[model samples]
Target: MDSPWMKRSRRALELRDGFPRLMAVLNKRKNFQTIPSEVSSST
Candidate 1:
């Protein structure tokens, strides 16, 4: 939606950083890291 929505979403979330940060760090579906990983092994 808008910038405000993004920031508010971050604050409201029980988790932190990820969902809101995705707007920047997320490039493709394959680029996302969802669970615990070996850094080079999963995501």
Candidate 2:
């Protein structure tokens, strides 16, 4: 797994910038799924 810091940095850059660069950064997690925080709290 990639470091949390690295992911945060890449996400920040993507949000700050735009277009092709953001697309490249975002593409890294194209297949990822986010478990909802509500579900975690319920568990």
Candidate 3:
């Protein structure tokens, strides 16, 4: 069985590893949204 401290540490590690991936996905979505709008406005 895992200790509570171990569980908390593991959870923290998971969040740390996942944070960049989450940021990258959010950035990609933002770019996807802006690119089309910019193109439409220019043309």
Q: Write the per-residue lDDT of candidate 1 for residues 1-43, one digit (tens) a residue.
A: 5699887766557335455655344444346655323323622
Tell me the lDDT of model 2 at 24.
62
Report the backbone clash tally of model 1: 0
Candidate 3 lDDT (Cα, 0 to 1): 0.70
Candidate 1 — worst ten consecutive residues by lDDT sum? 34-43
Evaluate residue 35 in candidate 3 and report its C-alpha lDDT on the 0 to 100 scale.
40
Clashing residue pair totals per candidate (backbone < 3 A): 0, 0, 0
| TM-scores for every predicted model | 0.26, 0.38, 0.52
Candidate 2 Cα lDDT to native: 0.60
Residue 21 in model 2: lDDT: 64
Please give, for residues 13-39, the per-residue lDDT of candidate 3 as tens digits.
886887798567668878877444532
Off by over 4 Å in 3: 27-43
Name the 10 consecutive residues with the lowest summed lDDT in model 3: 34-43
Query: Which one is best on lDDT?
Result: 3
- Full ranking by TM-score: 3, 2, 1
CA lDDT, candidate 1, residue 8: 71
| Candidates 1 and 2 compared by lDDT, better number | 2
